[model samples]
Target: MTAAGMRARGNVRTLVLAGALVTVTAALGMVGCTLFQSEQVSKGQKLYAHYCMHCHGEHGQQNEGYNWGQMPDPRPKDLSNKGEMSTFKDEEIFGTISRDMKDTTPEVGDKIGDDEFAVPTMPTFKYTLSEEEIWSIVAYVRTLHGMKLTYNVEARKKELQDQLQTAQQKADQAKQALEAADKKAEDEAEKKGVEVDEAATAKEQEANVAAIKELEAGKTAFANFTARPKLAAVPRPDLTMAETEAAKLAETGKRLYGNKYGCNACHRVGEAGGLVGPALDRAGFRLNGTWVYRWIKYPQSMKPETRMPNLGISDQDAKAITMYLATLRAPKPEKPIEKAAH
Candidate 1:
């Protein structure tokens, strides 16, 4: 073969090798992205189980007993409903999760001070979770409506930038308004030959200052924004116990009912407890053991209108509580009191 031909063949081989390397790199990058997203979803699942599953259910739908009579928006949102979930954007969901709808700025309207909905049932989580943790929850919630788990870092950055820009604009406009008000007031005072009241726009001045501070904070948040890393998975509670372990389980249940879970706050074990719920001293006689277990584990599932909030009780704890309650058999009434004579 000619020397030039041999050199040409070598060049073709080099190009093929380069293309293969590029393909392999692209594939690895895709795999890494997939793994990261999976981890985020896994973390989100753990969070949802711990914080949301009781109200939202094991799935995003409400628990089995769907009847929540008389309460406004009667039942918790059916998050698994694709059509309903489709109406909300990811950011809107994040905001809803983080803020109390009634008190959050811009979202408030005629409903803000309504007597009927004065206290929102959904609690605000802004104080409890970091921004990344909230975002992770949002990612997991998307899956309920059949969306993929994704964290669009660039998109979120743009949102932060837009928010910062809006805040800055509001701050500027407030400053200008305050300055204009002051100038007008000064001019009027000068024309009238009276002293200007420096405190005339005191409230407006305070509002302007607040707006400026908000703008500065927004800027800082935007500057520091970055993609959240995957969180460590939360451990699941152990629910395993042998059938013969009744005595020990009941002892644990006694501690949980009185101390750990605060069951006594609403229930009465004897003359010593609250009157909000029926006395449980005769729970063993009045209620079935199996029924007690189910009720404790998922209160809403049995009676949607019940005020008892599911405390995310584990199966083991529920069983223990049931056993403990079973031990509370009040001595049989000596004799049923005769009905009062009419």
Candidate 2:
């Protein structure tokens, strides 16, 4: 064979081999991504089963206690319904699942505002799951409706940091302005030969210090958005037990109310408690059992601005307490003796 002919054949073979290697590498890369996504979705499924299945249902299509189409307003969404799920963006779904439903008063804003809805349909998962875990759930949710989702943690973290920085800057600016006002007031008091209200000044200083501390703490704590919740889960009581067991449950509930739950510290029950909270002496008659039960379990869920802390009362304990409270109806007023004269 000629030298040129041999050279041309060698070059063609080299080009073909190179092309084959490129194809194999690309295919392997795609397979690796698919495997990683499958793993993420699998982890998310487990989490959903544990945390979401109670209200969202076994397959995200049914609610536990209510009839599907006949339930009252603000019912759980059927997550397995493709037509309904398709309407939401991935970020929207993630935000709905993880973020607080109500708009808390921003540190920089003057006017108070709240969400337009009466009550949130779902509880916030922010206190429960890490950012990565929430993204996993989002991926799993896609599978429920036969879809796919990919999340960028770094990008979202950057966005959150940017927002926090802006709010912090505003807060710092407000603090400086407050300090300047305080200094000006002090100077005026000295110039006018008038005594400053030392108590008010001290209170103002304390408030300013608290605001600074909150800002500093927020930057460090919320940087990673993971939280260790103060309350622990307690077992729920069975409300449908036999009537013969009522006295035992009430006695246990009374003990919890006075000591373990510490209700008497803030609320009065037949004059044995403080005035920090309203008297619970007749709360059973004044309030409905269902409302009381929910309030004891999750106070801020019904009233967002409430100072009540979730004390992590067990479900069974709450039901027991409810039963005890229900027995405290006020005595009826006596009829007048004038009826005998009539």
Candidate 3:
């Protein structure tokens, strides 16, 4: 063979090998991508196996109370019906697992804003896993079946969007209607020659000013005057962590909570108080101390229209309060928060 022919043959052999190698690498890369995204059911199941399976049951059929945590049902929610759960959109189920429904507000049913979980035992998982991991868990949970749901989320969102549009249109119409009515009223007033009696108006104004002054006088807690709450003391609103007490801060807390703050006016310690607030013997166990502290520091912050007046507690005072309450840990576990009155 000629020298050129030999070199050409070698070059073709090298090109063929390189092409085969490239094809092999591409095939492996595609396989790797597929595994990474592979609907991830197993990865999800494994994640659930690590975090949820113990209480939720191996197959989600376990019905047992918590060992350390106190729960009314003790048993975790069962999530085994495809037909039933099919009603929930991926978003809601994702919510249940990821959002820690217990951390949710009790009045509204499962709000993170509430003390993290209405069910005292459930821990909030907000910090533990990523969103993708949570979604994968939701997909795995979908495999479980039985409870019925009313509406899938996509449908609900659409329904809500439609309702919002309708409401906006109605609001616009009502505003226009109100403007027309107000214009008519003004026109009628002008025609009627509306007039005021100055002497009578002056008397009415004086009466209103006197009444406001009386109200103001009633609210002021003057030194040495022992201002009485016009309304009888109310049941304290659910307090925040700032509202509670812990061990270390108990000494100063005893003084402030008892005397200056007048907490004992409603709350009781050892037989030296009133029945307005819940007994504080085991306050720490009753509600999470953290929540109590929050309640104390800013009770009204939790429920804007709450009966409890803002006590104007400072942050330092709140910390001391939590420290004292921690000293009030229950000798034993409290009975599961009574199906907490809705």
Q: All models: lDDT? A: 0.66, 0.64, 0.52
Tens digits of per-residue lDDT, candidate 1, 23-140, equal 9999998998788677877887887776565456566875422221212233468888889888777777877766542422234222454332322445444534556667778888
Assess every candidate by TM-score: 0.44, 0.45, 0.33
Error of 1 at 17 (Å): 1.8
Clashes of 1: 0
Per-candidate clashes, comma-separated: 0, 5, 42
Candidate 3 Cα deviation (angstroms), residue 17: 22
Ten contiguous residues with the weakest lDDT in model 1: 64-73
The runs of at least 3 residues in candidate 1 whose Cα sits more than 4 Å from the true structure, single-residue gaps closed, are 64-72, 103-119, 154-342
- Give model 3 RMSD, 1 decimal: 19.6
Residue range 1-342, candidate 2, lDDT tens digits: 999999999999999999999999999989987887888789888887765654466677864422223222355678989999998888878877665434222452123335322223344555546666778889998998999986665466676677667667756776786677678778888998997655545655665677677577666555435432433333343466567687677776776565445555446565355333566677667887777787888775666445455555567778878877876775533531111110
Best by lDDT, which number? 1
| Model 3 weakest 10-residue run by lDDT | 221-230
lDDT of 3 by residue, 1-342 (tens): 999999999999999999999999999988975564445556667877766664565566534312112222333565664555566676666655444323122353223443232343233233345445655566566655632222233343355456555555555555565555556666666788874334434544454555545444433312102221222223333333443333445777665565345555445565445333466778766767567767775554565444343454566666666667767765653452222111
